[model samples]
Target: MPRVVVDVMPKPEILDPQGKAVLGALPRLGFSGVADVRQGKRFELEIEGELTEQVLGEVRQMAETLLSNPVIEDFTVSVETPVAPVPGAGA
Candidate 1:
């Protein structure tokens, strides 16, 4: 099986209250050198069948229509890379 990823983020012009809250808390929590922060969403779709252009297009459409709000946000779609199993994990 292959997995698809969709990342959605607020537009630069939009305000992100969650990201702001985290940014404000970071400094008080002993974190520094971070200038800014923007919050986003990631969606992973594990799908069956071969990875083809049509599948990619459908995923893109899903991102544009349902996964992300095109009005106040922008989205990026990609195929997720699979991780290899640990050499001795099963042992």
Candidate 2:
């Protein structure tokens, strides 16, 4: 089976309160070297077969219509890469 991943995030111009809160807490929590943070959403879709152009188109449509809001958010879609099986883990 194949899979697709959709990543949605607010536009850079938009203010991210949640991300700001986390950023403010980071220094107090003894964390440094991090300048900023932006929150985002990720969606993973399990596909039935090989990832085709048509499927990609449909996924893009889905992102445009339902997965993300075009006004304040931007989204990217990509096919998931398969992981190699571990060697000597099983028969």
Candidate 3:
């Protein structure tokens, strides 16, 4: 199985209201010395079957189209697969 990790975040130029709200609260809660705060979303998916080149292409397109907005937000994708253990004679 292949694991897909998607991290979506707002563009740097764009102002994040939610993050600002959280930051304001942090200072009031006796947590000082906080400079900046940025929030993002993470998604983990397990993809079964053969992860062919075509499938990877499709996944990229899907993430661009539906998973994240290209205007105000940017996203990154990471693909991971399990590695088989090395065969060896144990003493």
Q: Taking the tens digit of each residue's C-alpha lDDT, what string does model 3 give over 1-91?
A: 7777788899999899988999999968899988989887887867778777887787778778988899998988888765664689352
lDDT of each residue in 17-62, candidate 1, tens digit only: 9899999999899999999999999999997888889999999999
Best-to-worst ranking by TM-score: 1, 2, 3
Each prediction's TM-score versus the true structure: 0.88, 0.87, 0.78
Consecutive 10-residue window with the lowest summed lDDT within model 1? 82-91
Q: List the candidate 2 regions with Cα displacement exceeding 4 Å.
A: 87-91
Query: Per-residue lDDT for 9-32 in model 2, tens only?
Result: 989999988889999999999999
Q: With candidate 2 superimposed using the best TM-score fit, by how many Å does residue 51's alpha carbon deviate from the native?
A: 1.1
Q: lDDT (0-100) at residue 11 of candidate 1?
A: 94
Error of 3 at 58 (Å): 1.9
In TM-score terms, candidate 3 sits at: 0.78
